[model samples]
Every structure is written in structure tokens, then in C-alpha cells.
Target: MGIKVNLDEMLHQRRMTLTELSGRVGISLTNLSILKNGRSKGIRFSTLSSICSELDCEPGDILARDHSSLEGED
Candidate 1:
């Protein structure tokens, strides 16, 4: 994937569990897991907003470009 989710790192740094984030964001564990595990195809901006709000982070803190994945592109 070209985009990497830094969710686990953020959660660890914040001393919070995924379950707690789910509750705070009002999102399901399964959905957050999909995102955390980098298995998601996409994310809704509202969902991203809610997560950022709870985690006290910017979108860049959660998402980053996988520069290695762009190695073959022009």
C-alpha cells in the first residue's frame, strides 16, 4: 500500500488501547482494526476527524506516504 497508517504507534505513545479509541470515536472495533492493520481501502473524512479529535493528533500523525512504494513511479 502507498499509504501507511501509524495508528498503532500513536496508540502506544498515547497509552491508549484500540478499544478505548473505538469507544471515544464511537466507531466499531472491527472498523478501527481494519484501519490499524492497514487493510482499509479508504477512510471517510468524518471518521478520520473523529479519530484525530480523540487521539489529539493531526492527520499526518495517523497517515503517511510509503515512499518506498513509489520507487517505480516516474
Candidate 2:
């Protein structure tokens, strides 16, 4: 299975910049960049909560699961 963060798309859709989101969410720009670039291995609940609150979006809006490849791994 794999997880995908659609943050870039959402950011585009909302016409918001990374710097703006970082300030609004109170997360460091580097960390936010990592998340946006899908380089983050995990995310803290508090961070996720902050992002959701700031973006006014659900977790689903930012995250997605893909099980198709995993299904063939066995």
C-alpha cells in the first residue's frame, strides 16, 4: 500500500502559497515543504490538525491511500 499527499493540488486549487500555509498552520516552512513534496514519512496528529484547521479541509482532502500495487505483492 502507498499513501499520497495531494497538498500541491490543494494548494493550487486554493491559490495559496507555501509560505502562506506555513504561517497560517504554524508549521516550519521546511517541514511543510517536505509534506507538500510527499517526502514525509509520517505526520503528527497535532500537525495534521493544524493543517486541517488552517486549510479548512478534511484529512481526506490531503491524504489518499493506494492499495492496488500492494494487492499484487503477495
* Every model's TM-score: 0.90, 0.85
The 0-to-1 C-alpha lDDT of every candidate, in the order given, reads 0.93, 0.86
What tens digits encode model 1's per-residue C-alpha lDDT throughout 24-52?
A: 99999999999999899899999999999
Off by over 4 Å in 2: 68-74
TM-score of 1: 0.90
Q: Candidate 2, after superposition: displacement of residue 48 in Å?
A: 0.8
The model with the greatest lDDT is 1
Q: Please report how far candidate 2 places residue 54 from its true position, in Å.
A: 1.3
Task: Flag clash pairs in model 1.
Answer: none
- Alpha carbon deviation, residue 57, candidate 1 (Å): 0.5
Give the CA lDDT, 0 to 100, for residue 45 in model 2: 89
3-55: candidate 2 lDDT, tens digit per residue? 77989888888888989999998889999999988789899988988888877
